[model samples]
Target: SDPKAEYIGTEPWTPKEALEGGEITDKADIFAYGLTLWEMMSLAMPHLELLEGEDDEKEVEEDEDQSLEVSFDEDAYYDRLGTRPAVDLEALGNSYRRMVELFYLCTEGDPVRRPSAAQILQALESNVPLNINPSEVIVID
Candidate 1:
């Protein structure tokens, strides 16, 4: 399944829960971005720890209403990637830093506050001056 296509919601909700119904908005996409960034840095997802046990052949044979796994709020992607080595992000240089920052900005909590894809693309296209090398900020366990 496409990770981004996954739904996230529950009723009688905890603070951690979100309303799963209705539209897939840019906010949803931004949340996905935050999840993605955490994945990139942690070399895994925020909470999930194991690879998915089932496959396409063993796909859940339930409708949305009948499905329990339909809206898992956990960070399953980090588990899917398995063990990964630490990355010294500082080594990426200034250009790479800009790119990662773009990822973070794209994933900001407020969808309205995050930059649009067009803005991101424009930033990438624009010739901006750099001071610090982006490749130095490292990420580890």
Candidate 2:
């Protein structure tokens, strides 16, 4: 089963090509890495922790509707043209926030738009803080 369907929604971590049943590439791993990086920075919340343990048939149905609604909202907010993650700005500070922007690039809706793992590694190696303007900051996925 496509776990994204039952749980996490079509998050930035999910490759758009995979969702469309197209041929996926190493970029898919990069997409997942963006999400994992967010989770690691955001206190390690389990993927789809909100919908855990609703295995009963009845519960599943009920949860599905609610999940879809939440998923939709999340999708809108976390999308490339929408918002970003819900990390603690005060705690993470500006540098980490800039990194979030880079992660966002990794999760681009078009697989081709996403940065490769090697590019991401090079960016990380530069050791330069992203320094995104706070006014342009968006919400979390």
* Local distance difference test scores for all models: 0.43, 0.54
Q: Give the TM-score comparing model 1 with the true structure, all chains together.
A: 0.37
Q: How accurate is candidate 1 locally (lDDT)?
A: 0.43
The positional error of residue 38 in candidate 2, measured at the CA in angstroms, is 0.7
Estimate, for each residue in 55-111, the C-alpha lDDT of model 2 and write its tens digit.
722223336446533222344333432123455668888878767777777666555
Q: 20-76 in candidate 1: lDDT tens per residue?
A: 232344344444554555566656544444333356332234666875443342444
Taking every candidate in turn, the Cα RMSD to the unseen true structure, in Å, is: 13.9, 11.9
Q: Which 10 consecutive positions of candidate 2 have the poorest summed lDDT?
A: 132-141
TM-score for all models, in order of appearance? 0.37, 0.51
Residue 77 alpha-carbon offset, candidate 2, angstroms: 14
Error of 1 at 137 (Å): 32
